[model samples]
Target: MAFKIFHPISFIFLIFILLAPLGHAKRSTPSDKTSSAFDFIKKLKGCHKGNHTKEIHELKAYLEKFGYLKYENKSQATDDDFDDILESAVKTYQENYHIKPSGIVDDATISQMTTSRCGNPDIANGTNFMQPHGNKHESGSSNIHTVSHYTFLPGNPKWPPTKTHLTFRFSPNYPVSSVAPVARAFHKWDLATHFTFAQVGANQNSDMIIEFHRRDHGDGSPFDGPGAVIAHAFPPTDGRFHYDGDERWSIGSVAGAYDLETVAIHEIGHLLGLGHSSVGEAIMFPSISSGQVKNLHPDDIQGIRALYGR
Candidate 1:
């Protein structure tokens, strides 16, 4: 059995879910030889997402392609937290190119990562890429790292090892009308991860931003173009997720492509503290194909449970 999880969505977003080419081509995948997921992230292209021009642009394009952000911002996170963000971003990128959003960070993601990945390691790391002396910060504008999110997300202040409830909020932009589907996704967390969500407004003590856009909107990771980058987020402390509005998000089986919900599920995993699995069957795997992402695969469940020990 597929380990069914259930819950009904309380709120929903009404937006176009899918907008990419779909066709069940005879399961022929191109060969990719990259080893680690990050190395692959560096090689994705805009069409294949194999070679993004810039890291910031590549990050945004990945978010836009997937169209969902599970984490929020303005709070805190860390390099380890980036493990989740990068894994999720990589998964999203895979979904765009009709790959699986498995969170493995395989050859497909590497093939579609930023264009800069294939060149010098320093440039790929954004160390050698320097802004011109006159390229100082302008009022109302954020740079590459601070464009849409923060690179140095100070760890969570209230890093409680446990929580009350795991609330799953639908982005205000996506067309997620069916409460059942949204709730189904949330249920997966409860059953698999075991974290319950305390209605954010039940006591009404806190609120954070969980939406997406291009350029520096105050966070850190910024969007590059319409179809290049996806979106980013701050981990648990922030719980804010931003999705670039410049791409197409779809649902259901789209031939040889991935489902939007599948990508969202993987990104949500990041928001919840889980990182990439490096295993294809794991939901944490870096990528998935069209039909493969409709449901939560084994690898995904294993990763979540391992983190929270659910």
Candidate 2:
């Protein structure tokens, strides 16, 4: 998890998200042990850390840095064999993710055991989009993905590039609260070593226009009421990006709500010719937040690079 300290949210988080089908790792409630590993990991303390006699301290430190983990003191340690506990934790993670659970300390297991992750976004790199839950991010991301890639990648303009840049003509029609986060998101991309080529601004002259209203715009995508889904976009020629005004567009987790800027960044990822990444933890993987990088993940970078060749 991102934070060293565990979030005090209802343990149900395990049920709603962590336990959902994501990869091969399935964390079913163990009938033998009273509580399931989901329950156990949930109580593991977002901040507590046991000794480092082994290299597990790195995992503890990562959880601490992100502030999502609760380290348990050795005394609080489970009576289960250390190996079993580790196996169970990995299994629970795998079960929750739907990854093929070997139960052995394989690369997938170690990847989960180590990488520092964002809150609900605590998925490892190589597998984000391949998982079912990860697919949630790409529900409406096709336009941006296909369009952007067709224009900028090796395939050449499979579709005609609108010589006219419509992104500049439009202005940001979204809520004012979104302006800062939108700008922040853009700036974050601009800050990336690989984002140097991308431009920012929301007005007509800008490379892209972000809107926040509902009803069918020029493009076919319609914003559902806030919450469930907040926005969507068309590929290059569309030059139009939109947000569902109903959402509370913020930079943080919303309990059950989605983040506006995060969504915007995702849509923006679409606009830029990148496709949803199959890698589970990638920004392009279709969803991310909590422990996900506020900026583009490396695989996102790779995809964009493949499209633009930079």
Candidate 3:
């Protein structure tokens, strides 16, 4: 066996190589990325109308992205001034989230805004579904009436009436480990509704496409990475369900990780024509916290039933 000897310069190069991996080992965790994205909101906690700061412009953009603050033109939306328009938008957001409609960026509002949520807009085409109607209707028993909190996308787009059975295929870019959890989500929906979902091969054409994407992966709605937007799905007939690839995803309720099944189920609701529910307990609720696992709530069931009856 031949022994290799290192010269002074070569030995120093070897030491540097050994230390390089250690120096680069400390990578930013998913939670860190998620929190960092919305850290600006924390600084703007006490901010309200008439407060002209650059951060307010970020807040306005955040609101506008989620369909709260709307402007006629691009320039108006980009302004840093928190005018009456911004105040009204804030109030609407507060009312929707069950916070006091103070029209100010309070602690509660800041907390809610920083939470990881779906990428879909709460208000679609000027229609705000975030406001819970609590519309009461008779249940199976005539005496028993239930209040509904579910709403639909603008125009209530849905699959064709005759197209009861749907085929879904995972995009080639989807994480292989995620297939099982997503399948379970489809199964749950199948059990609850009249629709049946079948998974096809990736190469085959399918009615719905499930994929993981990062920021600006097309479809007009770009994802905001980890914290702000976890995932989004299109309404029926345009079955494009996308998960933010930057999110820390997990199979179960793992700390600092979003449960894949919970998100899948929520997105599936959108794919099936159901919108966000004001009822926090519903799976279709706009936001979910890390380590939280939510099953279908009564609101979800009622919403689907209302959209497509048995």
Candidate 4:
């Protein structure tokens, strides 16, 4: 059964959540990946009404694709107008994410929507990828909640103890500051698990190769520049971590700014063979936000301990 340990979100920016593509058809042009809806929403003089505008239609599509909005017909045409259904969806999303639940598509909401994030799917192929480890149960009941704090990739395989000192090196093109957060990210996992990360020179052979690249950097998972995928990592025993070079990565705590350290920590969790958790507070949680300082939750500690016996 999946166990949960909830905590109030304490970040300056609540958190950025991941959005799934309705379908995966790679865009050939940069313009194709950028959404004008955010621009339009910002220009609105007041709250939009239930009139079908191109921007409203885009908003509907965005909300619906991300599990906030639900309608009777998937094939139905968008009127581009705000309605009670859309309002409710916006409010629900706001409340769930700890944003102010004003049913209007305000600047804060648009900013959150436009923020880039990791490419990992929170729910893939209609399946909750994070499955319970079948260890814990609720008190006074045999029924177990179908959830997880963290999950493994397909095989649940882990690195052997013999592979303790893993070497990593970053691409030389990125700023030196980028490497600092990555080292910190690795340190966090090192403290949690039985392994240690060794930073090596660029010419040295390494187990993990970290790079910053824009769209179509030779991987099947091409990053959409800005406002979409911020980074991704290969699972354990095969370590290739990529961050979107197009993103405005920073180490600051300024609200609405993406923190490199936060994302690196998440990608390292993936590199350590952890999957997305349904538990929102977990370091392995599928999403993150700009200006957020993420620490390993107890659930995250429990998960790594379960996997590596640390």
Top candidate by lDDT: 3
Model 3 over residues 14-120: C-alpha lDDT tens digits? Answer: 56535642232223333543454677899897888888877887888889888998888777788788889999999999988899999989999998998889888
Better of 1 and 3 by lDDT: 3
**Model 3 segments more than 4 A misplaced:** 1-34, 134-146
TM-score of 2: 0.43
lDDT of 2 by residue, 76-100 (tens): 2422233444444444455544456
lDDT of 1 at 64: 36
238-282: candidate 1 lDDT, tens digit per residue: 676565443333345543333445655655665775444433444
Backbone clash count for every predicted candidate, in the order shown: 80, 58, 0, 8
Against the unseen true structure, what C-alpha lDDT does each candidate score? 0.41, 0.41, 0.82, 0.65
Error of 2 at 88 (Å): 31
Q: Judged by lDDT against the true structure, how good is candidate 4?
A: 0.65
Q: Candidate 3 at residue 165, lDDT?
A: 94
Ranked candidates (TM-score, high to low): 3, 4, 1, 2
* TM-score of model number 4: 0.63
Q: TM-scores across all candidates? A: 0.46, 0.43, 0.86, 0.63
lDDT: worst 10-residue window of model 1: 115-124
